[model samples]
Target: MRVVAVLAVVVLAAGCSASEPPPEDPSVDFSADDRKVTAEPFLYCDVQVKDCKRDNTAQVKLEVAPGTPVLVSVPQEVAETPWSVVIQYRTAAGEQMPPETVATFPPNKSSTFEALPPGDGDQLQTVEVKQAGAKLVRDDKGEAAAVSRGVWSAQISPPAA
Candidate 1:
């Protein structure tokens, strides 16, 4: 009887162990050269310029991996402003990539912009802003440009499956 009981206990333990899921692999498949740029969450500031007649200007920095498609979020209030907002990517060497106009939004609003890789073999990306017919206005002693007053976020990731 004792032998049978021991055998049952061993069988139960083995069954439980077999039913457990396999351990997950911690290794990520992305190459070491791949990089991503994201903006920290912060309060958006409303930018108003007198000469340009533009308002609600926000600046965001994005980092993109080579050959990867990145999505950028632009301030929403661009449409209501007098000037158009241009988005450009600046390389690490301080050279500006070709500018692409994503969208135009009304005042006190938000919008998302998508940026894709050039399909060439270049790396190291950053974002640039050019306000048409408006000069960049600096807020009270702040080095960064003023964005709309709202919760603004930006991110870079792989394309959807």
Candidate 2:
């Protein structure tokens, strides 16, 4: 009988804890060259309710070899919202390469992306993930624009010569 009571208490405690929400906000992860880093959103907002906050203090940086691919992973909170991966590269000769949006993923479509460095010995300098908010507005040209809801960015430093 005592064992049964103890088991019930343990089960009850586990259930209660499982029902509680996470203590911290979801984070984005970047992995490359056998190293991994995580970053909280420097800016985040709920577009439907127009609630937003910005933190200039948060940043994540990692060092990787040139021409290596970086893997970007997002939590469900980010994956459920439309998001895109933007990349910036630097040539081997230290010339800045034009930024490119590698791909835009629809809501709940993807949670992981492999960001490939462009050929020609270019190195990835930055990988940014932008989450589309719920609000939409028309631009000057009358085209609809989806406002940015959350941003998580990582800067990648190349190995020293």
Candidate 3:
């Protein structure tokens, strides 16, 4: 009788201390109504302008989920003129972020500029460009001597409960 009593106590204790099964992995494939849900990282890019004259400017908008990282590129050619290029971003709250300045470039030389996404929470971002101090001017030769810009972005959504 004593042995049976001890066995019952042990069984009860084990039942009481039982834990829930491990959570389902989000990456696993699930099909309901013949629909499969898959996990994927979100990413996107936008180009606002293809060409920019020396005195003119171009703009691009890059939007990503909060906490995402993004990379942007701007390529320009400034031949022999001691000219400067300035880049800036606008935040979701309609505020302008700090400006990035690239100093004088040799004539006929092309260079690229890059920017990283904000470290803060997810928000929409915008990019703008302009010459340091001169009004953009397109040459009469119909050659739109300008810069090329590109944006790359990625977003990670929060895990499900």
Candidate 4:
């Protein structure tokens, strides 16, 4: 009888704890249907933009059905920075497609965007967000050039046919 009572108490405690919501993550969020995936910055640079490296191999994989659009939501920090979405697609014949910058948002202009899959049997392979700072990169001749200051990327897998 004592064992049964202890077991009941433990079950009740577990159930109660399970009712609490999980903590929210501070990273890029991708959602489609009822599934959601979050990815931390794969490459983040400081204000100096010199230390553009990440030690951990952090990656997020999201499975999206063909023709379905993936919704991307950035944190406030990213929203306040100038950013653009770069998408890469793969042809049905397994040929790699060129990456395209689908959308570019100015600072404080957007926090959410939709990534549409390529039509006609092509599959979306990857999605990346490149955040650029107001600063420019210097070339060999010290000319200014556009460059990304931070990078966040995610992989998208198509369902098996």
Candidate 5:
């Protein structure tokens, strides 16, 4: 009887904790070399809303020493949806990548590599940012459902000559 009671209590406690909502905000950040840059990884989630502003955009610009790796750091969060992290660079020659991205459909977590610009006598002017995942959708039964998502990105460049 004592064992049974203990088992019941454990189950009840586990159920209670699981019912709690996960943290809506996760700690996500970007860096240019070792210097951290301003970022809001969830910016794309704004578009998932019904009355989102189309003009909203998130951008980060930083100048770092040559050969530094632009990086994305997400210190593990309750990621339970498709999330994307993108980073693109424009070479001094005016070229860009197809936006590095990641997505998921299940509860997940992430760590990512954004970019590494050449340390030579070259510089990056701007990084085109596009992070989109996590969404609100209509179910087959005509019900509204929410999907979770997370995203991050970074770009690097040397000082303009």
Candidate 6:
């Protein structure tokens, strides 16, 4: 009888502590239908520096299903100041708006932004890396001798469906 009592206690304890996946992030609009959303292709852009030597990336063309939340992120390779973003998309009413700053980040940090889509259907998504707070130092010849460069790459996150 003692053994049975102990087993019952253990079963009750395990049942009480049952693990559950965290509720979907409130900012993200997760789909009710179990359809998987595939990741879009990498759309990258480089610094607009006139004499930029290194090839860099800044933007990516984003596409996701209606209910899938757009996960946008920028990597901080160099310790540069704040980051800003400009996103252009069609409204649910099919009106197109010019690209504008949708979000911004503070100085010298890497972060992610979660944004929801307008409504059901496809939209033209354009994400641009507006500013990374990078500066350039030049020689007397007006040539880039040294650069206070910030390397960053922007892309989608949570690749898994």
**TM-score list, all predictions:** 0.31, 0.79, 0.27, 0.73, 0.46, 0.43
- Rank candidates by TM-score, best first: 2, 4, 5, 6, 1, 3
Q: How do the residues 17-84 of candidate 6 rate in per-residue lDDT, one tens digit apiece?
A: 99898432111111212432322212212343443333333223233544355554443432144555
For model 4, the stretches where C-alpha displacement exceeds 4 angstroms are 1-26, 138-145
Distance from true location, Cα of 148 in model 1, Å? 13
Q: Please list the C-alpha lDDT of all candidates, in the order they appear.
A: 0.39, 0.87, 0.35, 0.81, 0.49, 0.45
Q: Could you give candidate 2's per-residue lDDT for residues 1-161 as a string of tens digits?
A: 99999999999999888875635656899999688999998888875729878877666898888888899999998899889999999988888988899989998999999998887677899899989887889989999978888888898887777
Order of candidate numbers by lDDT, starting with the best: 2, 4, 5, 6, 1, 3
Show the colliding residue pairs in model 1.
37-63, 44-148, 45-147, 45-148, 76-109, 76-110, 79-105
Clashing pairs in 5: 67-119, 82-104
Deviation from native of the Cα of residue 73 in model 1, angstroms: 2.1
Q: How close is each model in CA RMSD to the real structure? A: 17.8, 6.9, 23.5, 11.8, 9.4, 16.0
lDDT pick, better of 2 and 4: 2
* Total clashing pairs in model 4: 0
84-128 per-residue lDDT for model 3 (tens digits) = 334344554656567555343454453333333344542324322
Task: Quote the RMSD, in angstroms, for model 4.
Answer: 11.8
Off by over 4 Å in 2: 1-23, 139-142
The alpha-carbon deviation from the true structure for residue 42 of candidate 6, after best TM-score superposition, in angstroms, is 11
Report the number of the highest-TM-score candidate.
Answer: 2
Per-residue lDDT of model 1, residues 1-161, tens digit only: 99999999999999888865743211111111344343322332334423222222232334445555444433334324432233344454546577554444444454344444454543424332222223344768866443332332232222334
